[model samples]
Target: MSHIFPRHSAQSYPVAVGGEGCYLIDDTGKRYLDGSGGAAVSCLGHGDPDVTEAIKAQLDQLAFAHTGFFTSAPAEALADLLVEHAPDGLDRVYLVSGGSEAAEAAIKLARQYWVEKGAPSRSRLIARRQSYHGNTIGALSAGGNEWRRAQFGPLLLNVSHIAPCYEYRLREAGESAEAYGLRAANALEEEILRLGPDTVMAFMAEPVVGATAGAVTAAPGYFKRIREICDTYGVLLILDEVMCGMGRTGSLFACEQDGVAPDIVCIAKGLGAGYQPIGAMLCTAQIYDVIAAGSGFFQHGHTYLGHPAAAAGGLAVVSAILQRGLLPRVQEKGDALHARLMEQFKQHPNIGDIRGRGLFRGIEIVEDRESKAPFDPSRRIAANIKKAAFEAGLICYPMSGTIDGKHGDHVLLAPPFIISDDQLDELTDKLSQALNAVI
Candidate 1:
């Protein structure tokens, strides 16, 4: 009877009528624990009064403003706050509506930066296989998730894809983790050389691979080597933190733990914490200065760029993250959650790996733990797990085609920063039940 088009036309969905903290209530009053934070978007959890009030106040003062003619106070303030806490050398913020737009802007900016520097041929982009950037044309071209790109292959750009820093699948039997990490990162250098370094503009990747790869963190020393390669080849290192940044991975920025800063970083999801649709693309002042000194125009824009109300909500969410001492809590609680997962699934036959940082964690489902073999794609393991978990009144992110975009599955858990110990227990119990029923 609904006129709206649904994400899955064949499936009817429960109406989310209300939410409180870590739980969402349906019209029939079924409460689902928000274990995955609704695709890791609701970091502060649902119905936070502070974020709501900020948006409301902004709407009262000024609901919207076009960035062409003017910039709003909220937008300026939000950008300032983001840059204040961002990684070293990243001094500029370009606000957008969400993750896709942020990534689209980052790609265009990277291309523009090279052009302004008089290197117009530096238009190629290299990203990791099994990685996801976003869904727009440029962003999708940069992503290496084959499933998402299969139907749109002809429309995608000619972006190169290197091997991912996936230790579990790619590491040799006797290689040390550190050695494997270095080897994984060196793939970027090889690809850049093969393609001619002069033609490479940027290398894009998620600090902690999300969605397609299920919170896959890079091996130790991996990002450091990547930074070195990009530096040597004059290729800009662009880290897409759209799903893993904004304190989702224990740090304010996910790359902070990796001990390297990127030339440009994109963030969303947790920025406005689902209170408002907002995202930002931040870059080094050096890059900004290049365009500033040249054309003084980036030649890119969106209607909702630097939207006032969204900016206000993002400012409040980020302020709460810093002011209310939630970063440390995310770490502390993340450790606790990881420990519980390990203890619960240690002897389980099908659970292959438990990995990730902060509240972002992934449980890789395998046919056999000894061989680390994935379930057959025809089994639809991830899809069934998602269905079972939803029926069990728990919301989690389980994605199929995790390995090479075809033959693996993983369940990603990204609970809210405010999830209580009791709620953690409930989440684990529900997830366990779902796994048992499906696996």
Candidate 2:
């Protein structure tokens, strides 16, 4: 038996030996197209020379520097780059090792900001049902995915979950999409009133729900209403862009498309583009000023918070994204991918819905398209599709419990920004074969 523990203990996985562009090669020389970018992390594909050289250079200068003692050049530069393109009012950055840490920091920063402002009662956090932030205890508490939080319930903090702005499922019959968005966004106001707005510290959500719900986009005007409500109630709006941010959605930040900015935002995945493990939590100048003026410290950190090498990787990855002009390409290519998917799956009985933005897209699997009814959980549709896809030389992200914690199934496709027209067809073909194999 292998000494290393895997994600799934019961199953043995292929040993991936190398990655070239958008494909991963196994030890046996089998190549698998990176359709989902390994949970949407590798936005630059793989084996990027620029990113590698940057990492190597940084390793020579400084690999790691304890943030408690000294800060590194790469870390500082990375922060500057992030703020340059950050949403309005967000001017500070807190570096972390990965998405979970960034999320944990965002939550703690929200609480501490309130404490600094002398509102000790602002302890409750409000999020959306069917949303996912991270897997760490504090972050998990804020996420509304019942399945991810079930076993850890006893340890999670109290969090109020409001309905998500999911139009396909929650929009009532005969309701306009815009009207449904407003109604869904209003749920936050109701929750705040019930919890006494003063007691709620922050409202956390993803601009585009990932992983658990696939690439579920919000209805029009949803986030604008959400931002207005947060401002009125003095609640900090925290946007978790761990998967949807950093040019994945054709914009540097996914909230840019929503036309609303958050008080705090967490981002990862595409930051280092899988060249290095990294994430960051960004906040407004006002929040930083309050903490700086009062305690002079935010009071939360990890040992690897700002490792130089990781920051170098992130810096290069972002620079490549901006300098090479990948954002607009993402838009053009994404539209092409969506068009191809619609053309291919328009009549697929099991392909219930094809929706998403830019390179990040999702296809909901269902049993009844007219009713939008999902496949039964017992069918293990998502799992079966994932296995079939992998076996057919593709790597796609598919998950169950898309509707709630157990009702729906979806396949999330987030290819690298460098994916080509031919590659898009290859992705759809492989996905279709997988779906056919399973359904």
Strongest candidate by lDDT = 1
Give lDDT tens digits, candidate 2, residues 1-439.
Answer: 7998789998899999999999999999999999999999999999999999999998988888799999889999999999999889999999998999999999999999999999999999999999999999998998989999998999999999999888888899999999999999999999999999889999999999999888889999999999999999999999999999999999999999999989999999999999999999999999999999999998998989989999999999999999999999999999999999999998988788888999999999999998889988999999999999999999999999999998999999999999999999999999999999888
Could you give candidate 1's per-residue lDDT for residues 1-439 as a string of tens digits?
9998999999999899999999999999999999999989999999999999999999999998898999999999998998989889999999999999999999999999999999999999999899898999999999999999999999999999999999888999999999999999999999999999999999999999999988899999999999999999999999999999999999999999999999999999999899999999999999999999999998999999999999999999999999999999999999989988988887899999999999999999999999999999999999999999999999999999989899999999999999998998898899999999998
TM-score of each: 0.99, 0.99
Cα lDDT computed for each candidate against the true fold: 0.95, 0.94
TM-score of decoy 1: 0.99
lDDT of 2 at 248: 96
Superposed Cα deviation of residue 9, candidate 1 (Å): 0.9
Q: What is the lDDT of residue 268 in candidate 1?
A: 95
Off by over 4 Å in 2: none
What lDDT would candidate 2 get against the real structure?
Answer: 0.94
